[model samples]
Target chain A: MTTTDLAQSPAIPRDGDGPVFREPWEAAAFAMAVRLHERGLFTWKEWAATLSEEIAAAQDRGDPDHGDTYYRHWLAALERLVAAKGAVGPAEMTARRDAWDRAVRATPHGQPILLANDPRSCAHRP
Target chain B: MGAHHDHDHDHEERWSEVELRVKALESLLTEKGLVDPAALEVLIQTYETKVGPRNGAQVVARAWSDPAYKARLLEDATAAIAELGFTGRQGEDMVVVENTEAVHNLVVCTLCSCYPWPVLGLPPAWYKAAPYRARAVREPRAVLAEFGVAVPEEREVRVWDSTAELRYLVLPQRPPGTEGLDEGALAELVTRDSMIGVGEPLPPAGAAA
Candidate 1:
């Protein structure tokens, strides 16, 4: 389906009825997923299915569905989709995540968290 | 204040988790050449500065000042909103639900985060969270109470379920005793959460502030 259809479709997430990102990283997670899907990495249908699965799985696990875990689910689904599509392996994602944790810790407040040259910057590695 | 400060460590840990997860995902997509960091940056910048709650606040201000505009807004929100230039996909089929002295309006998207991005920018984390979605529809009063908003018992609380095609924007009541205020000054009283119905506009003379 077209982007217009997807936007109007009940499937793909629109992130809300509009700038409500409580935290800075929520916006990043949202922009990341949207940009990836917009680039044709995955169809909106695929995205919806994966995302719904994450939400359902959470519900199954007794998640209160208070919306706290929404982005966590979004992240999980995105990771699963990309990993399944051969974008990155589970190990690589884990390693990069750890690197980001380190980078975030080492970086001071008010500075852009650059990934390169940071001990945990794995994306730039050959 | 100390109690609030005590949550800092928990907040920090959660923030790092979200931040690092996003970074990891972005990295994966970037490495695979499936996403452009520049494009993502542009999107973030747009939401951060432009196309935010300020736009909605302006619309509310205009409606408050101009009776003709308020009538038009109540009649056709999408068209009236577009007159202010909040058009396009996100603005289409937009419905403006007015809050009155007897009734308050709240909005939620239970399915997903279907929000009016053209005007509102992005949905805050809480708005997109499952708690807000599930509770806003089921127990709006409790949810509003958590936001420190106590709607009177006589005031009816109307919860609007924003969907993919249709989105709802709350037109909070204009504060009283602001008759001398201009549209721009009135707009200053319009806050982001108030328009979402989780809070109310500050009264005239900044009584709450």
Candidate 2:
């Protein structure tokens, strides 16, 4: 089904339906959305729209599980907020992620290491 | 949405093989040093493109703003977390254990790192395998101590054994001096390990340093 289908379905709650997290982290995210909405950072409608769009894209890519689909959407929502607010720039974020991948690759199998923090480095912790 | 069927149960074995294949490929690339540069580039882009850290940050933010929600979170974690707006499919079942002066909770899937990926995004490599899973649960205090978290001897340490069916995430205590901070600011204090219960959330801004 399309994201619009997911969004419009009565199975999903509308705004002011109270929290609807199935996972603890999802609840955590819902609470954050509430706080942000209260502070005028973004409306619940906007967040829902963004998340729905994310799910739709995942469906297009052949992911059928709505719950699994939401995690990626959740991450995208955060990235949008941080970027929109200039918490960190796209370039800096990309560089740090690249560094993390490199560290994981360099470490032996079964041993993953995160790069040491560098003041001059472009990556900031998420 | 659909009725449960016996065939769905059989799908598990197939997916496990798929997981194994992916891991094997990843390991092979790492061993060849072929994965470092490209993989890192791809890794960063993947998170930026496919996975984001917002979910984990949200949990941290909520605990800071609402005392009642936080209390519920520490108690019947599954229902409390569902109260927000996340659940289902990849979300799976979850349990949240609290860390306190008298008791500390740590989570690890010893057989395989069956993390709550829907909420936490991807599981870090260390979280998915034998060494860490086996060691962390067995000697939690020692492990935390190595991570520079010092738990007192008087506190009862509780290690939650994670399985494929039930995943666990640690609900760290809120940091001090964060009173009155907005949600975004509070989210900044959350760390990956804090949610995993390896380390506590950092003290607000400069409180610790």
Give the winner by lDDT. Answer: 1
Structural similarity to truth (TM-score) of each candidate: 0.67, 0.47
Q: DockQ, per-model, please? A: 0.26, 0.02
Please identify model 1 stretches exceeding 4 Å from their true place.
Answer: A1-27, A37-53, A64-68, A80-126, B1-28, B31-33, B87-89, B206-209
Model 2: CA > 4 A from native? A1-126, B1-53
RMSD of 2: 22.1
Please list all clashing residue pairs in model 2, or write none if there are none: A19-B83, A19-B84, A20-B84, A20-B85, A21-B82, A21-B85, A21-B86, A22-B86, A22-B87, A75-B52
Q: What Cα-based lDDT does every candidate model obtain?
A: 0.76, 0.55
Which tens-of-lDDT digit does each residue in B120-175 have in candidate 2? 76565455433455557656766677566788899887888766457787777777
Candidate 2 at B184: error in angstroms? 1.9
True-vs-predicted CA distance for residue A72, candidate 2, Å: 24
lDDT per residue (tens digit) for residues B1-209 in model 1: 23434443432322366677778878777877877888888887887777788888889999999999999998999999999988754577889999988899998877677777786777776776666777688678767877889999999999998765688899998887889999888888888888889878777775655
lDDT for each residue of candidate 1 in A1-126, tens digit (9 for 90 to 100) = 355633442221223334445567767777877776767777666776687778878888987655657778888888898888777778998888887776665444556766653554565456
Q: Best by DockQ, which number?
A: 1
Q: Lowest summed lDDT over 10 consecutive residues: which window, candidate 1 chain A?
A: A8-17
